[model samples]
Target: MARLEVRQSWLGDVLGLSQSVVSKRLRGLLPFTGPELLLIASAMNISLGELLGGIVNEKNPHPVDGGSSGVAGGRLDLPTSRL
Candidate 1:
């Protein structure tokens, strides 16, 4: 059996972006756009949850319709209490 490897260049190809862009995103110089994230999730043959890095929280319900609240895949954790 051969080893399956994932590389930045491969990811770049999957995202239709240059390797430098992928590197920049990896290094936090740029943010991963929503489409890029979806493509990456597809290319890796992984679920969105796995691609999201296990940030699911059953206790905290996220806002719908693109609300700027709740934990965004571990990016943040905001208080859900409406005061």
Candidate 2:
């Protein structure tokens, strides 16, 4: 979220998420769909490759459609590709 703030000039509220929520998501404990990755990347004004922390081998591992999986606070809807 700091990156988003510094690099993209976006506040947490602008992304419709709290700072803690965004921070939790960045822990990478759960899998993120293409669109979710895209949203985060766009919000941070960075590339997906950078978002994945240079994990090129694991890029595009899953097809993003629609689904909800249990997360910390609640189920998060998997995002589809917006590209």
Candidate 3:
């Protein structure tokens, strides 16, 4: 998602997290909460399932809507996954 955002020139300064924290989280060395997941998804303009990918059972799932695609306040519904 980050890659896609960068490609689209939509990547912005990450809010509420330090560079080290962002690095660790992106490198799979740290865990993120449900709300955090939602924030990340909202920042990247994608669905939580798309962000969580393999952890979510995409074949059988509920759809999410009313999310923001801009760089502002958007509703984020994080998936309940044990990642």
Candidate 4:
């Protein structure tokens, strides 16, 4: 948010949530729902992967690339098209 100069109140307004709720999620006191994450990512003009960058496995940064219809680590083999 600092990078974007987006205040908590503004983000809360955009997400249709209260500032406290947004704060809790930002502080890790509450988890951001998938929809909320998608909203934030869209608002920020970024991809969902970039929004969830912290969830990546540092040891194996690239995706495992499991066979088609198989799971790669915990992520599915999905396309990178922008939402």
Top of the candidates by TM-score:
4
The lowest-lDDT stretch of 10 consecutive residues in candidate 1 is 74-83
In the range 13-42, model 4's lDDT, one tens digit per residue, is 989999887676666555555566678779
In order of lDDT, best first, we have: 4, 1, 3, 2
- lDDT (Cα, tens digit) per residue for candidate 1, span 1-83: 01236667777788788988767666555666555666766877876555555444465343222323223431422121321
TM-score of each: 0.61, 0.43, 0.53, 0.63
Tally clashes: model 2: 0
Shift of residue 37 alpha carbon in model 3, Å: 0.6
- What does the lDDT come to for candidate 2? 0.44
- The CA-based lDDT of model 3 is what? 0.47
Which is better, 2 or 3, measured by TM-score?
3
* Residue pairs of candidate 3 with colliding backbone atoms: none
Better-scoring candidate (lDDT), 1 or 4: 4
- Please tell me which model should have the higher TM-score, number 1 or number 3: 1
Flag regions of model 3 displaced more than 4 Å.
7-13, 58-83
Backbone Cα, N, C clashes tallied per candidate: 0, 0, 0, 0
